[model samples]
Target chain A: MPKASSGLLSRSLAVYFKDLRLELRTKSGLNAIMMFGVTTLAVVSFALGQSGLSPKVLSALFWIIMFFSAMSGLAQTFIREEETGTSLILNLTAEPNSIYIGKLLFNLTLLITMTTIITPMFFVFTDASTDNILPFLVVLGLGVFGLVAATTLVAAIISKASVKGALFAVVSFPILMVLLMVLVGATEKIFDNESLSAVSSELQFLIAYVVVMTTISLLLFKFVWRE
Target chain B: MWYKLVLFVLMSIMIYFSFALPAPQQQIGESSRIFYYHIPQAWICVIAFAMSMFYSIMYLRKKEIKYDDKAAIAAKLGFIFCVLATVTGAMFAKVTWGMYWNWDPRQTSIFILLLIYGAYFALRGAIEVEEKKAALSAVYSIFAFVTVPFLIFIVPRMVPSLHPNDSIISEDLKFNIEGAISLVFFSALALFTVVYIWLFNIGVRVQLLMRKQLEEEDF
Candidate 1:
């Protein structure tokens, strides 16, 4: 059992690194995501123009940018494989679980990288302030994890469909609505100068959302991947 | 045919009682008359979605085309009922809350339900192969249903909302509704379930026939 499990982990890591190398070399997914994120941020900041937005609106705007950025790039993980005809090779080499894990890890890396860059830019451009920095980070971590976990399986599903672009966001937005709602709530509270404990329920919901989403995605990914 | 006749008679009586029997609610007055129609539409919407999920699971387990047909038909009916619920609820909100759309938790949840199934139909449309479409949509159906509990029950209660909490059932687990209101409300709920079942059966049969016709044409 241990040997089999270790094999799974190693194979998954192999898939992850393969994706990372491809991403680094081609830079299509990262470039699209970052360019979209930065451009949207510029347009939003330019449009709003020192209006002194409320915390609720600012928190919502932050996650909206993240959401659209994810919609822009995350599907590239599987779509690339399908488009380039590499999925057949990957399917032969690794188990569905391993491929799912690898792609999930790859998407996580892309999303975290995008978040790290876009977040500070978001704060600077909008002049958004959160009194509780530690809690804000925690919320951001959980929120991003939940977002990627939920979208990864969806990316796989949409890759097989004939129509790809807007379909991904249309299908994913409803599933991720619960995650976005909780993230916005937690971030809004933090921006309102409330302590972490005040938003504990929202944090707990975020944790629960991530756990539930990842579990189902892992369980369901094989069905999507196999066919 | 007899059951349909009985349904017609029962529905007429129910509609009549909903309007003619109960006294106008104290606060919202006659606007509360929408409760019978609105709540039943919402209840049946959830029921149809649950049925869709059940059939989706069945399709995945048995790999049967019939289950896929049933699942898709149930979703189509559910989407229709969901729209009915939303429109009816919006009218109720307009009368009571002085607005057409409040973004209340219930309202938001139902709206998301609409979008979820809208995406379901879109996904079906995007796939041309029969088995793949069936399998993929069944998988998507199950995934969407897994989020319904969170969307309907948990998220709505998480925030303070203008939606009434104790209108039907109280904290003490007793029915807050009295006499005629309770009678018509429960009757409407039961009747709507039957109505959904009737529609679902017809839809599945029609879908199966259409597929059979298409297959014959292909040959």
Candidate 2:
């Protein structure tokens, strides 16, 4: 074992690798999330006939997929440990910040994979047009950061609960509603071919949301992490 | 206690003012009366949530089991008041705007607040382990409150809202309170705060008793 003073990054990375290895072997979280994301996209695209979706509605539809898919899977990081009776082992082995960061990174990877597939498929299926590609990705990046930053700790909180799955959405939607609304607005601006400056305000809000949420999660993780 | 009588009399006076006072002419029509009930319900709802958050912080800081009881009860009462606000606000919307669920910024924000607190209770109900439930939920309560400002203030400003700006903060709301209505409004505010505290005290007592009973059961 490494010295306890190996620093937060190394400790966190140790946790990250542990979970990543387990995840690769099990593939449960990724499969559930991807299945939900793609299935939602397929059903919605077929129902809406893949056209006539204004930028506004298309933006909303895209996020609704991301949101529900996230709802389906993001809690699994903490949930998996609890279900496998490894929560206390993780708690004892890792610093709380390390565990939190590790889980957050795991969630980030899942979200990135899901969004990468869903965004292109959504654009093709819904024919959602974007006038500015770069700003859209920036907003998407900020959006995912803020969403997982808030939910990672919340996922830890709900992991102990009996009603884990539904409770995650109930808790998360309120916190993420502000970010989602901003993303939709930013997406609308991007579709209108607005310049980066036009998207700056939404980007700013997303940045603020991410910072505030991350600070709170870092501060409170110890309380939620241990029994 | 004398405080209970004070609440009762003050509540009666507020009701009288809500109905007996002349309605505003320009916008609300007879529906202006709803404000007397609606605003206080929403304000108390906010007060209850704030109180819950405060106690949750206290629980974390002190690690006192008592703080958990107080926090849980405050959140429960707050959630109830929030529902009352949404329902009354909807009724007011139906009368004034001719629709029940308009997704006005104020309405949407409160709905979000409702969901947040609902999750708090759902969380409490889901965890059977006593100490773990208290610790985790207290942390969750504090974390969840970070969004309250954005949902209530920033989001409202960003969206084009059909709900008027609160009369207390901005004159930009559909109708401004002046003269007699102002007196009634302030009185209702005072009455509601007192009533909220009174109910909160009862709630803490009841939660403590329930906790004691559960402990005895375990023995």
Candidate 3:
């Protein structure tokens, strides 16, 4: 058995590759998430029939897509670990801190990838475009950073929960509310061709939220992960 | 017992002086009276959460059952304070903002606080084994406490607030007086702290009593 942590990046990369390989082989969590994303986008687009899909509304719609998709993905991140009973084995064999950081990094990657795939779909389905794509991506990326950090932390807490689904949302949604606001504000700016600095307040908040959430989660993860 | 006596006295002074304090310089004149309970409730909610986190750390580090009990009690009390804060805040909002509910950061965060702690209790109720319940709830409590400030304070402040961001504390304290009213607020804070400790001790004792009864039944 190969030791996972060659270093932080390699270790996280290793876990990411392992999860990706397994997910690819099984075609389960990721597939479910992607299908869910597509159905969600389609349903939302059809639901808004002829409302003219204004840029502001498109921005909000984009975030709602990401939010629901992230929750569906994260809820299973640990559920799979638990199903295989790999959580205990991992706990015994590896450093708990490394496991947390590793999972967080992987979840971040999944969110970024999912958002990457969905952003274009969101663009085509709605009336968004490539003109402000880079700035829009930047805002989406920052918001996802906050989302992954907060969700992974909450997921760890809710993972052991007996009543899982409702409980996870209860623990996560409130904190995510801030990130959602910033993401929406930034998206609006991107669509309007405004400077990223125009939504600088929201940007600063997105950064602070990611920092605070990650710091606290790292400190508290060990306690929550303990049997 | 002594803590309770002191608490009662402090609470009496607080209630008595609340009726006597001068109205604050603002639009929400008579409604400002709600702060006499509202502010203290919110502050204690924070305090209870902090205490829960501190005990959580101690329990995990020491693997002590007593620390677990302490954490559990503090969390229960924290939940009570969170509810009080929300209720008092709703009353104040109705009087000042002309509505019982608004999406003000303060209001939103407190509501979230209630949900988080509500989930905390639900987690505790779901687990059946005594030791597992203690360990898991301790872990969740610590995480939830860590989550609260971010959810309740930092996030809300990041966006604009309709509620005035004016200072409740001193802008300049050099000449500030230890007036009768300040005394009342401080006293209320002191009283709440006492009530918290007493309630916590009682909770631990009750848990112990229940455990012994269960043991007797097992025998």
The candidate that achieves the highest TM-score relative to the unseen native structure = 1
- Going through the candidates in order, state the TM-score of chain A alone for each one: 0.96, 0.97, 0.91
- DockQ head-to-head 1 vs 2, winner: 1
For each candidate, the alpha-carbon lDDT, in order, equals 0.87, 0.84, 0.72
Per-model i-RMS: 0.9, 1.3, 2.7
The digit string of per-residue lDDT tens for model 1 on B58-133 reads 9888888999999898899999999999999888778766788867777889999999999999999999988889
Model 2: residues >4 Å from true position, as ranges? B24-27, B161-179, B215-219
Clashing pairs for model 1 are none
Candidate 2 residue-wise lDDT, B1-219, digit = tens:
998887888889888877888984444478767777778899988888888889888988888988898888888888888999999988877876677887777888888889888888888888998888889889988888888887776766665433453442243254567888888888988888888888889998888788789889999
TM-score of each: 0.95, 0.93, 0.87
Rank by lDDT, highest first. 1, 2, 3
lDDT of 1 by residue, A146-190 (tens): 989989988998999999998999999989998888788878889
User: Candidates ranked by TM-score, best first?
Assistant: 1, 2, 3
Best by lDDT: 1
As a TM-score, model 1 comes out at 0.95
Each candidate's fnat, listed in order, reads 0.60, 0.81, 0.42
Q: Model 2 residue B77 lDDT?
A: 86
